[model samples]
Target: MSDRSGIFAGEDPFAIAQGWLSEAEKIEINDPNAIALASVDADGLPNVRMVLLKEIEAQSAPSGGAFVFYTNYGSAKGVEIEQAGKAAFVMHWKSLRRQIRVRGLTSREEGPQADAYYTSRSLKSRLGAWASDQSQPLASRTALMAEVAKVTATHGPNPKRPPFWGGIRITPLEIEFWADGAFRLHDRFRWRRPDPNSAWEILRLNP
Candidate 1:
């Protein structure tokens, strides 16, 4: 048996993830929720960028355990996600020396939840989403500003969520948690399950 005790002792991986995130929130300097989101292009080249994870959803069987984030549907990441139907991300907390990695299938989350999130954003950000043709080349910053101004006037206050902008939910098949340890050895645990409703099998890996 492995000496997986203390913070790693948990039947629910999601609970452990939540606890780690809570600790990270207290110690991180900024953007505690920022994750390195990874997606593969049509050519199989990997692309990664920092994106804020909006939510860790926990629901009943066949409909649970997803990481949520929003972006323009036409963006490079979005196109990759739609084409591949899968993605992965890593969240690292330097202060805590801990990291969480996830790989999963992707689906669009463009219902009331998307609408509510859109409404919660700052007016400028909401307007910016409407103004930006993300992943497309722009001639100049001035042109972008002009587009923003035009959209601001056209959409006005109480603007609706754009059809091209919404949320993507990732339902993970695997998640790994890692923490720093002394003597150049680290603590690592992986939780894997075939589907959300299936029982998770935990494995302790050498570090």
Candidate 2:
């Protein structure tokens, strides 16, 4: 007999994830798409930060399925991901008392999809992306505003996505869904595979 039911009913982990996220967006106070992205540097030190998840591609996607987020290709996380070829992230919703964790191989998403997402941002955000030298030291806030102004002037009203800025997609080999339970217990289900192309082997973890 299986315990998985209700919210954990789906066979496709990606679809289940999308369902959870859609529910979270209605209750989460802010940034429902926020994920704590984790990566490692060349020295093997761990790095983690909050990033807004841009998309959750379905299993039918060209790359099978992925979690997508964008950043400056020259940024610290970006550089580390390129060096390590892997990353992990967890998206938790306090309101729903649930979380989804993923570990996976990464690749750049620098195509037309990136362009369309860049175009969807507000003008100021788009310009800020062009202006900011992410992960680099800036002298001061004033200097940053000045740079923003410079880019605003140079790039005009409709600037293109910077060559150094785009998306990164993580195709997970492991995905875990967890929800709180009573009396300090928790429910956890993990779907893992040897590779992205392999069938997931599901397991229930003690929590």
Candidate 3:
């Protein structure tokens, strides 16, 4: 019947992703959750950067499933996401020799979930979030640290989440899992849907 076995065996793509991430957490030397997030600006020029994926919501989530990451809403990528309403990312684990690619709809997650994550950060990080004008040209390191000092003095130890910062969730229309194989041939399985509410159609692709 279906050849999807071992690491590729899972009914739900989101579940498969979470399981893979859990395994990576044990052996990945660094940030196992890092993703190369891709977005496009108003001009249609593409941009991509590495960002830590904060969470992977399961299929039971209200939005079905989503990959979440936080950043300054005023940042370039944030502005692009707001403009385009879509984004893509690839989470590659060099240690595990595997990767997950996703492309989908984007939305702001600025409610309680955002607040809780913001609150979980270290005090300096919280203050730094308030201080830094992300993706903007800065005068120098001195200027940045000066601003950090200023925000630290003003916001104190329990600085609240900055108004310009929160989570951005990408609800994928397509999710693909790929693993390294012997002899340069790779195993790939793509799960795609027409829209957020549609059921996924799975396909095994050529290497």
Best by lDDT: 2
Model 2 lDDT per residue over 1-207, tens place: 188998999788999999999999999999999999999999999999999999999999998999999999999999999999999999999999999999999999999999999999999999999999999999999999999999999999999999999999999999999999999699999999999989999999999
Q: Provide the lDDT at 181 for model 1.
A: 90
Instruction: State the lDDT at 106 in candidate 3.
Output: 95
Off by over 4 Å in 1: 59-62
Q: Number of clashes in every candidate structure?
A: 0, 0, 0
TM-score of each: 0.95, 0.98, 0.98
Alpha-carbon lDDT, every model: 0.91, 0.96, 0.95
| Candidate 1 lDDT score relative to the true structure | 0.91
Better of 2 and 3 by lDDT: 2
Q: Which is better, 1 or 3, measured by lDDT?
A: 3
Task: Put down candidate 3 lDDT per residue, 17-108, tens digits, no spaces.
Answer: 99999999999999999999999999999999999999999999997999999999999999999999999999999999999999999999
Question: Model 3: which ten-residue window has the lowest total lDDT?
Answer: 1-10
lDDT, candidate 1, at 167: 98
